[model samples]
Target: MKRVLIPVAFLFALFAGSGSAAAAPPIPVEPTTETLDCPGFQVDAVYTGKAKWIDAPVASGTKKRLKLFTGVAAASTATLTGPAPTSKVISLSLNGSISWSIVLSPEFDIVITGTGRNLISDPQHGDYPGGLFLTVGKVSWSLNAPDYPNGGITGPGSVTDVCALLAP
Candidate 1:
């Protein structure tokens, strides 16, 4: 009895002290439509996706969880369309995958991975209004709020302005 209790107590204490919350069920990203102002026309976009939400207070040794969202946008896609003054309705890839996940470190630094949409829109500062980014491999980016002023992105993926493709 003493030996059993000893192991049990240790296990309980370890988990109890971790200060981490259990992962929640995946959140369904419902289909939504939005219009984006392009250079000369308006871009109508339909977005759909899902994300497995997680909340971890702290990790084992580092003081924060290793990762939170895993199934986030693992299976996601998007559709975009634009007006055509010169021709009929213009459109890009009817269906495109836009999978991505966010990771928070001990220092609270955010790292986003996978192919998806990225926009650092700060009214005070200039923003990078990037549309769909597709890559053969994988794409990742480090986010710093104050860093983006002129609107830019540096990564391995090829950026496709859905608006441009649909524009006439």
Candidate 2:
């Protein structure tokens, strides 16, 4: 009985300690800082657009905001990979005589347009937006699981502008 109990206790101790180590704490690790420098190329043609809409403010007694929509087209063969991602904003006029002035608040909002993919892309394609991203394309963009929560939440909170730019 003593001999059997000894082995059982040892086995229990080994597994009890191992379980804690296996369950790692959930802390986010920052991305690597190493930069990639790629040669630049001139674009022949380009097309892009952006739009944002906001509901009444979430908190108390805030003025209602507006939405933004802009588009552009460009035809060029620009290589789109480098140490850091590049981005640009295009502006569109409402073309109306409204008296209220609308401004884009620099807060982060998901860009839900194909022509303006600079905001997010498939992780496999090296265009994954870390905070929240949805796979608009039909390919594997990352080795790990893709993020899907932000896809459900929809609202333009801080953005107050719609713009676009395309050149040949």
Candidate 3:
């Protein structure tokens, strides 16, 4: 009886220590900022998003699953500068649904889809007011389980020419 109890006690101690040591800690996060530069254009925006852990916290690692969503009415606006010389300014509006998974982890992934809409503008060529207008379809991009330090996001489609009078 004594010999059997000794082995059982030792096994319990070993298991307990291993379990405590293998646990991971939760990862703290704050507001993050990201910049996206389009061809001939640049946009700077803040990420106001919400994140929730899918499981309990650990002591040496982070949560394996996380669900994230963009904040209410979170949007990014920028000015689209046309070709050189004239350097015409076109108001650019970007609204979308952004969701992330495995956030703050190496397996992090993101999916973003911009709400499609027409470009807002009021320009004149020659002597016509409101002679320039353009429309852009819904644009979407995503970052799947990408390779570390070498992942690439998809690009948006080209803008359609709706203002023939302002053609240069």
Candidate 4:
């Protein structure tokens, strides 16, 4: 019995030293102020939400939806410095049926509602690398859109990377 216990203890020690049992680092705390930027637009807005981890086999998964305060979007981007035109969302939906997600890892889904020359039109569809950057406190994550022209938007006119405008 002593010999068996010794081996079991040794195995446990070995596994623990191997880093398999190591605790995951604490998730980054969300910041009070959030800023979202795109190639041709930028918005510094206040968000109300929290990010939490999701159960998974391996790797950490976080899902977060930050709803921008009403008028914050317009107030933040009041001055347009980028090449893209001054854009605003007449109506935005980032909760309920539609929500924006920023995953620290590689997979995430973010959705917003707005229409502009260089912004996400109605019913924007994307896979990964959706050209979205969401800043939560000090940590930030970039959500990729599908690899395609005009952010998978049909019809004419240049609609390239309009999703970035919706980040917050």
**Candidate 4, 1-168: lDDT as tens digits:** 000001111111222222221134222223333333443345443322222222213324443443321100111111112232444442222211111233333434433322221223222223223233211111111234333443333332223333444433
Judge candidate 3 at residue 158 and give its lDDT.
Answer: 42
Model 2, 42-86: lDDT tens digits are: 212121221122222233344343323222211111122222134
lDDT of 2: 0.21
- TM-score ranking from best to worst? 1, 3, 4, 2
Instruction: Give per-residue CA lDDT, model 1, range 43-92, as digits (tens).
Output: 56554544433333344563442453322332434455667665324322
Q: Quote the lDDT for 152 in model 2.
A: 25
Candidate 1 TM-score, C-alpha based: 0.46
Task: Give the TM-score (vs. native) of candidate 2.
Answer: 0.19
What TM-score goes with each of the models?
Answer: 0.46, 0.19, 0.29, 0.25
Better of 3 and 4 by TM-score: 3
Model 3: ten consecutive residues of lowest lDDT: 1-10
Stretches of candidate 1 exceeding 4 Å from the true structure: 1-30, 37-41, 48-58, 63-66, 74-76, 84-108, 115-132, 145-157
**Which number leads on lDDT?**
1
The C-alpha RMSD of each candidate to the native structure, in angstroms, is: 14.4, 23.4, 21.1, 18.7
Comparing 1 and 2 on lDDT, the stronger one = 1
lDDT of 1 at 90: 36
Across residues 1-168, which tens digit of lDDT does each residue of candidate 3 receive?
000001111111222222222123222224343333222333332322222222223334455545432211123333344433554555434332222333445544444332343232222222222222223444333444221111112236344432332222
Candidate 4 stretches with Cα past 4 Å from truth are 1-31, 59-91, 96-147, 150-168
Error of 2 at 52 (Å): 17
With candidate 3 superimposed using the best TM-score fit, by how many Å does residue 55's alpha carbon deviate from the native? 16
